[model samples]
Target: MTVLVINSGSSSIKYQLVDPESGEAIAVGLVEQIGESTSRVKHTYDGEKHEYEQRLADHGEGLRFVLDLFDSVGPSLAEAGIVAVGHRVVQGGDNFNGPALITEDVRDLIEELAPLAPLHNPANLRGIDVARELLDVPHVVVFDTAFFQTLPEEAARYALNREVADRYGVRRYGAHGTSHQYVSHKASEWIGREDLKQIVLHLGNGASVSAVVNGEAVDTSMGLTPLEGLVMGTRTGDIDPAVIFHLSRVAGMSIDELDDLFNKKSGVKGLAGENDMRAVWDMADSGDENAREALDIYVHRLVKYIGSYAAVMGGLDVIAFTAGIGENDDRLRAEVLERLAPFGVKIDPEVNAVRGDNIRAITTADSSVTVLVIPTNEELAIARQTMDVVATLS
Candidate 1:
């Protein structure tokens, strides 16, 4: 059976029809700039690409265009044998532990939890609502927070008043559960060991790190929201919680103002006015001192987490890099592993420089820790989990 993976963002939708058992995407498409004056649809299949432009007034219209393309192009949904839709829900919070078949009750619960993931859950539910109404397929809600359910309480809690935390549902509920889970397992398979301690650095426009033992998530970087992890392209990661007070008390910043500042204006963008790592590197190379400082700050946070998580997990066996920067950026990889040389971590410079879509090791055979570049496939992970959830239901 085929599974449809839908990752709907605030203004975009990414979808794929996949045969999870064989790990192949029978069809894939993206709807970007939704609700904009002019939106673009990029669809791919059978080694060919097609693009369309139209006014996608909302998620419903955007998804309709996607279905239209499938029908007009090749390998229609019926031919793909689509059985279930795997919707990527970002914040499952305290309620979910795995993929859930969508129901009226689940939909209401997701809407209720929107405040916990203000930027993600609403968009996620929007896609689910549309697909349910349009497609005659069972839907599975694959949560990004589901994998981190295995995180021990000590690792998942914040040092706040227990009563207030309980009342407000405040805690370290890590994001990027799908990508982290995908790469960690692939990392183990590459090393030919399932029980090795691993650290997965998912460095994209949004970044997070995960410390995994065997196949389970023991600890992760993101907490409560995606905004709490490492210094990302636009969000401040770990900061003094008291800073919010200072900004309000002294700077006269409101909660709304602070939210926009940290979530949209801070991080590398706040420092150097550039968030793309590639552009930031160029600026730094051109003697932009602020960009240089931003780079220092970004790597400092990553290196610190690597050591802390390694200590937490006793020792690190495989240090896997996934996502955009993690997979392709050779410079950042070298910078991070170089600092860990004292821990007997070694990278084959030649291997580290090579790039591809496949899993490969950058560390030498003699290195104490195996450093790998594992490409992350979140859609596939969601499809498998979605299939698993729907299978149980059937």
Candidate 2:
């Protein structure tokens, strides 16, 4: 069986056709610049890439063009036996704890929760709407917040005014829960232990960490939104609330301006003038103080989270790193583990330096904590969950 996993962003649609049982991405494609004058579609199959440019006025148009590519390019959806279409919904709020079959009511619920993920949900819903109209197969919505639904109250709730918090649904509904969930399960499987105390650091352009006990999430870094956690590529994570007030009063910034500043113009970019970690490292090598400081802040925040999550879980059995920076950047991993050396963490420098797509351990055999670099496959996770919902129909 195959599943087509679609992740729709504000102006792009990223998709993968996957065989969940084997975890192989049979084909992958992306449609960029939707609603723009000129849009680009790139599809890869059978080790070949097909690229094109056209005008895609909206999500419906973009998806229609994608379907056309599938028909013309090869690996027809019907020939591939696509069992279901999986949609990645960013925020399910407290309404869904697991993947839900896309009924009209579920679609409505996703639309209703858009305010919580203003930049994501609406775009996600657009894809869902267009896909359902374009394809007759069962469709499933997999939420990024579903895995974090298992978080304990203390970890999920905010310490705010009770009435105000409850009324506003103000709680820690984490982002990137899908990646966290995938990595944690992969870690457990790699170590051959289900009852593990795991701290999963998903460090990419967008980063978050989670503490999982056994297979359930106990605590996560992101709270209420994706903006609440680690020092991301362009996001100011863990900023003091008073800074907003100070900016408004002293800097004369409006709410919209402050929002733009915090989300788009901050973090590593604000500090180093470059958002990419590789660029920061390059500048640091050239002795750029700003770049060096950004790298230091990024590593420092990661170390602090590792220590805190270890405390939250009472003890740590495994520390798994996944995502762009986590799986690729050997130096960052070395720096993180070096700071954690006091806690009996020891890295096999030789093994850590090797790069590949497989899940492997970087820690020494006798290290107290088994540190691993596991490649996260959120698309496969979504496809599997989509299969689960499809299975229920029979």
Candidate 3:
């Protein structure tokens, strides 16, 4: 049987149909620029890709276009034998620790938790409302935050007044949990050790680091929201909370202004006026002081996290680097490993230079801690969890 995984974003619908038994995607497609007059749908199946440009007024219309493409391009849904549908719900807000069947109550709960993930939950619900209308099947919500539910109280809780924090629902709810789960498990399998203490560095445009012990999340970098972790492409990470108050009182900046400033105008973008790491590196190579400083700060922040996480877990066994930057940038990997000499983490220069879609060990054989590059498969993780959740019902 095939499971359809739907990752509904604010303006896009990314989908894949996979056979849980085989773990291979039968079809993949994306409907982008929803609500725009000129939108596009790119569908791939049977080793051939087909693209269509049309007016997708909204997600519903875009979804309709997607369905039409599936019919036109072949591997029809009926032929695929889709049994259930899975949705990537970004923030479960401490309510759901795993995938849930999309009952009315689940839908309502997803809607209610919108405040926690203002930019994601609503859009996810929008897709849910549309997907339920379009496909009459058992729908499941695979939360991105669910895998991190294993985070201990000390790591999950904030150092704030318990009363106020609980009242406002504020704490460290790390993001990229789905990716962390996928790669950590993959790394464990690759290293032939299930209980190895691992650090997953998912360094994408929106970066996050997770401390996973024995395939369970113990700690993570992101907190309460996606904007709180390691310095991201745009969002400023690990800033003094009082900076907001200081700016408001002394600099006369409004809270909303501060929000936009930190979330959009900051990070590498704020420092070097470029959010892309490649561009930052380029500028640094060209002797741009601002860009050079930005790179230093970014690497320094990551170094501190690596050291602290090793201490938190008592010790480290492996370092699994995944996602865009971590998997591709050999220089950055070398730089970070160079700082971890005391941790006995040494990378083979030749091994570190390799890059591909498969799992790889970049560290030398004698290195005390294994260092690996594993590609993340979050959508497949969602699909597997969705299948597991549905199997329990049977």
Candidate 4:
């Protein structure tokens, strides 16, 4: 069966049409700058790619554009017969610990939780509504936070007034659950152990680390939002949040401006004036002191978390790296493994050189823990969840 997965962001919509039976993507692309006059879409299928620029007043219009492209590109929309439409919903709150069918009640619940993910939930709802109108197929909402619902209460709760936190929904709701969950399951299989203790380092444009015990998320770095975690491409992760108040009192900046800076202007971006790690590494290699410092801070935080997770899990059996930076950057992996030597982690330089979408063991055979580079597949995870939803309905 085929499934269509949609991940809607504030100004972009990424979509993938997958044949889950074969575990291959039939078509995938992104429509960016929605609500902007210069909006554009780039789509690819069967080795062919096409780009288009036009106005997209909102997600509804952008999704319509996607439908037209699917028809014009190659596949007959009917023949593709998307059995389900899965969304990458950012927050599901305590009520939804798993994927759920999109009903009016579900939509209302999502709306109520929007403040927790203001930059994401509204856009996600827009995609859901638009997809529902265009396709009379099953629609499922797979939350990014749902995967971490397994976090122990001690790990999930904050040290605050219980009544106040519950009233305001101000508790830890880890992000990157989808990526962490995917990598953990894949790591378990790679390690050939069903009950595995694993640490998943999902380093990328936006970074987070997770500790999974026996396929359940025990603890994760990100809290409430993606803004809390290891240093990211453009986010200041795990900072004294009082810095927001300090910025307001000292610089007289508004809350929106502070949010913009911390969520979009900080991290390695603020330090080196760039977010792409490749660019930062190149500058660092050429004697850019600030860029070099950014790299150091990024890797240092990752190592710190790995060590913390090792302690949390009593001992880690496997460590998996995934996402854009983690799976491809051999040097970064080498450095992280070097720091994890206390845990007997070692990367064979030859094994690290191999790169692709496949999973591979990067550590030497004798290491205490198996180190792996497993590419994350969030879209496929959404698709599988969507398939499950459809099966239930049928």
Candidate 5:
């Protein structure tokens, strides 16, 4: 049996038909620029790619077109044995601790929580509504924030006024919890220990770190929204709250403009004038001072978090790096771990330099902490969760 995983954004839908038992994505596709004059659709199956363009009015039309592609192309869904459709919802608030079957009530709850994730939940709900209408399969919602529901009170709450915070639903609801949970569990399985204290750095265009103990999340970087946490590609992570007030007063910047600045024009792009890590690295190698400083700032924030989490967890037994930069950037990994030399972390340069898809240790065998590079598969995680939720109905 297969599960169809859907990660819908404000303007695009990314999908994968997956075999949960074998962990293979049978087909993968994306529909971009929905509700545009010309929307692009790309589908790949059997090692071949098919691309097309059409004028789509909305998500429903875009999805219908995708269904047509599935029918016209090979591996028809009717024959593919699709058991469930997993929708990736960004914010679950404190309402859901795990994947939930999409009932009318659940769908309404997702809609209710839209204020918390203004950009993601509505689109996710759109995909869910359309897919449910068209597919006639059991649908499941896998939340990015669900895995972080286990965070302790101290980690989840902000220092602001409790009344206002509650009224505004302001708290540390982290993004990338799915990735952190998946990688942390894989790290525990790989290390053969369930009680290990671990830190997972999900470094990508969007970066976040989490502290896990015994396979449960204790603390995470992102708070209130994804705008908090480690330095990101375009976000001003961990910025001073007073900066907003100062900008409003001195610069006369409206909230919307300030939001645009911090969320879109800041971070690596703000510092180095380039958001892509590879471009930043090229500039740094060419002795561009701004790019070099951006790299330093990024690594500095990482080191700081690692030290803080080590203290919070009492001690650290494992450190797992996943996601794009975490998995591929050997140089950044080396720099981050090397800064932790005082903690008895010793990474084997040879092992760290080797690039592969499988989980492997980058630390020396005798090192105090077992450092690993585990590739995160969020799609497979969602698929398995979807299957689990569907199985409960039977």
Candidate 6:
């Protein structure tokens, strides 16, 4: 069966068409700079890339452009056997633990939870509405928070007034559930032990750290929103909420202004003036002091999470790094491992040099915790879950 996964953001839409039987992406693409005059799309299929420029004022237009792309330059949906449309929903609240067949009630609930994921849920719902209108297919909403639903109440709850907390739905809702879920299974397979404890550090443009015990997510760093996790490409992770009020009252910034600032103007970009780690590394290599400090802060933040998660899980058996920075940047892997020395984590420098989908143990033989690099495939995880959900419904 084929499933088309749509991940819609404010100004962009990412899509993948996959065949679940072999777990291969038949096609993938993104529509960028929506609402801009020179909006563009880059779609790839059968090892060929097709690029086009057009004005896409909204998610509906963006998705239509995608379907038209496949119709013009690639295989038709019928030919691809696209049996289902799986959406990347950002928040499921406490109600959804798995992918749900999109329905009027589900859509209403997703709309109600929009405030929790202001940057994502609305856009996701827009794409959902467009896809449902444009295609005659079974639609499913695969939530990014669903995997962390397994987190125990002790880990998921916040220490606040019970009545207020319950009324406000105040709790940790971890992000990157698809990536964490995929890598945890891969880690279990790699070590040949399903009953092992693993720490998954999904480092990328957006990052999160998750603790998986015996194939289930126990705790994750991202809480309430993607902004509440490890330092990321742009978002300032784990800041005091008072900072928001202070910026609003003292700096005279609106909530929208503050939200846009922290979510888009901060993180490694605000710190080093560049979000790309490669550029940051290059500047640091040339003895740029600010770049050096930015790199240190980034790695330091990651190590603290690793240490904290280790404490949470009692001890770490395996540490697996995935996502963009984790799998491709050896410098990051090296720096993270070096800082985690106190935890008895050691990486074999030679073994860590390889990159991109090549899984290998980076840990020294005598290290107490095994360190590994695993590439993340979130769409495949979505496809698998979509299939599982469809099977149960069947």
Find the candidate with the highest TM-score and give its number: 2
Error of 2 at 5 (Å): 0.7
Candidate 1 local distance difference test against the native: 0.92
For model 2, residues 281-386, the per-residue Cα lDDT tens digits are: 9999999999999999999999999899889889999999999999999999999999989889999999999999999999999999999999999999999999
Reference-based TM-score, model 1: 0.98
Instruction: Give the clashing pairs for model 3.
Output: 173-224
Give per-residue lDDT, candidate 5, residue 215. 88
TM per candidate comes to 0.98, 0.99, 0.97, 0.97, 0.98, 0.96
In the range 24-109, model 1's lDDT, one tens digit per residue, is 99888999999999999999999899999989999999999899888999668898888989999998888998889899999998
Q: After superposition, how far is residue 312 of candidate 5 from its true place, in Å?
A: 0.4
Model 4, global lDDT = 0.89
lDDT of 5 by residue, 20-93 (tens): 99999999999999988999999999999999998888889988988888899957998999999999999999
- Using alpha carbons, what is the TM-score of model 4? 0.97
Give the alpha-carbon lDDT of every model.
Answer: 0.92, 0.93, 0.89, 0.89, 0.94, 0.90
What candidate 4 gets wrong by more than 4 Å, as runs, is: none
Better of 2 and 5 by TM-score: 2
Clashing pairs in 1: 173-224
lDDT for each residue of candidate 3 in 38-145, tens digit (9 for 90 to 100): 888889999999988888888898777777777888678888888889999889988888889999999999998898889899999999999899998789998878
Query: What tens-digit string does per-residue lDDT give for candidate 6 at 1-394?
Result: 6999888888899999998889889999999999999899999999999999989888888999999988998878888888888889999998899899989999999999999998889989988999999999888999999999999999999888989989999899999998998898998898899987899999999999999999999999999889997889999998888999898888999988998998999999988899999999999999989889988888888888888888888878999999989898998889988887876777899889976566789988999999888888889888878878788776
Q: Which wins on TM-score, candidate 3 or candidate 5?
A: 5
